[model samples]
Target: MMHRQRGVGLVEVLVAVLLLSVAVLGFSALQIRAVSATDESLVRTKSMTLVRNLSEVMRAYPEAYVTVSGTTFVTAAASDAGAVPTIQAVISGSATNTVKVDSDDISITGTDSCLSTGIKTVDDKKVAKQACSINQLAARDALMVKKIATDEDIKVNVTTCPGTTTQAIQTQMCVITAWNSTKAILDDDDEKACADSNGIYKSGSQCLISEAY
Candidate 1:
């Protein structure tokens, strides 16, 4: 029999430690990726919810988006129309195309007046609760969008659907949402761009486009 084997060799102990460290590092990387994916999915869900709310409001007040000579939809003539202004963009990359509603304008009192206090009846000599105009309703709708976007910390861009022109009043509208992420930003000429000049989305971008008729 040999005199006796030492408890363990230094080389063997160092190799075991190295192997454990490698395994731990690999697991850590996987955990990080999972967390990132989960976060992105949550943001996408929030974006979808915002789009749904906006679509419902638009459908409820169809007259708010008046058709101009059976062609394009235009806002009615009203002072509050300026509150929900839309900037027509020739290209999808135009920064001005993005319309962010001012959260500061959100006030229950301000909207209450727009809802039920404006027209006074001379015959009754009392303030009659008048129905909100299409313009006022539209302004309210925009504010709702602003509130949601602010809460979600995202950006929204509303425009006519891609490959379709505003020449037709019935053209589908697109609600595009984007947030800060590791993925590529919305741009042109890049394979990873979120949206092209036509407002169509590509893979690998952190953006979601929802279309509503």
Candidate 2:
């Protein structure tokens, strides 16, 4: 008679089943979170690898600055303003140019003109000039890789004060205007070609080359 009572209890069995279900659910949740984390890590790793590869290519051709579509890549020139120059390279996948890394953009920025001891009155002009120079250099390098001619009607315009002042006076004001071939293309089409690249001038997936005059 006592053995019969000890056989099983319905309430106990139900509680055991509920506990097992909870454990299974927790494990499933843990597995899903792990998978999501792994996928995100993989994406970041791929982005880093892409940037590294581009840097290696640019380093190989130190003198050359290249761009595809709207992306421009070039080395930045040094300036006395103690600004850190930046270089960028971008690549996008394409079915036609799988190995080519088709959509590429590169840009370079000269030193900053806003340093504490730099030009005070007007530094924007100097920065603009530097940016123009970098853009031209990038266009020239890009042409070398492709059949595009970068020198069709190049123009360099600078807006400066009527009278130039010495560095000590700090009254000079000017702006540099140059033909930005890559920018022109992007502006004309209103579409960015270089969505990914290395550097500091990224604007909503587009690379920009800018500096304070």
Candidate 3:
């Protein structure tokens, strides 16, 4: 009887050790996943802040994106086959041409200094300081974002606003200041990563689009 009890004790001890091992491994995996998620979240927050900042910065430059009056607003038709049913309830009076007035895409992209007579044109104001033109500003913004995104092996592209595939709206313009690089942060080349399809990224290229601002 004594020998049998000792064998049973050994078996119980072995089972306990096995359970402990599994628990340790599970905790370790949990920790790794949590850390990864947190890192991704940080990237998203930073990207969003950058997007908003650029919008406000561009807002300071009215000439860069000043909308003309009597322009139509972008709209979706109710009966359109491509319209998403889940979100179509918001489309009012479908079947007619939806108008988007005062909407203008940034037409230029370059590094040419738009300075005049020692005064720099920046953020819609002419100042006695070194500055960039609207085109230059857009280029620099794209470059800076690319630098930030690439530090993590991510790529970024800043194309002219108003995606090339979509038709232009006839009404008022919506100012899209910048596109952040966090969209492709995961190295995923998914379409939602950026508003423009022509600038698809491969692996760690975050595509941030400014839809409104």
Clashes of each: 0, 15, 31
lDDT, residue 107, model 3: 15
Q: Give the TM-score of candidate 3.
A: 0.45
- TM-score winner between 2 and 3, please give it: 3
Expressed as tens digits, the lDDT of each residue in 100-145 for candidate 1 is 2221121333533345545677777766465545544554565556
| Ranked candidates, highest lDDT first | 1, 3, 2
TM-score of 2: 0.33
**For model 3, how big is the CA root-mean-square deviation?**
13.6
Question: Could you tell me the lDDT of residue 59 within candidate 2?
Answer: 41
- State the lDDT at 199 in candidate 1: 69
In terms of TM-score, the best-performing candidate is 1
Listed in order, each prediction's TM-score against the native is: 0.66, 0.33, 0.45
TM-score of 1: 0.66
lDDT by residue for model 3 over 101-175, one digit each (tens)? Answer: 223221123223333247767899878665444433432343344344445443332223344433122211122
Off by over 4 Å in 2: 1-8, 65-213
lDDT of 3: 0.39
lDDT of each: 0.55, 0.32, 0.39
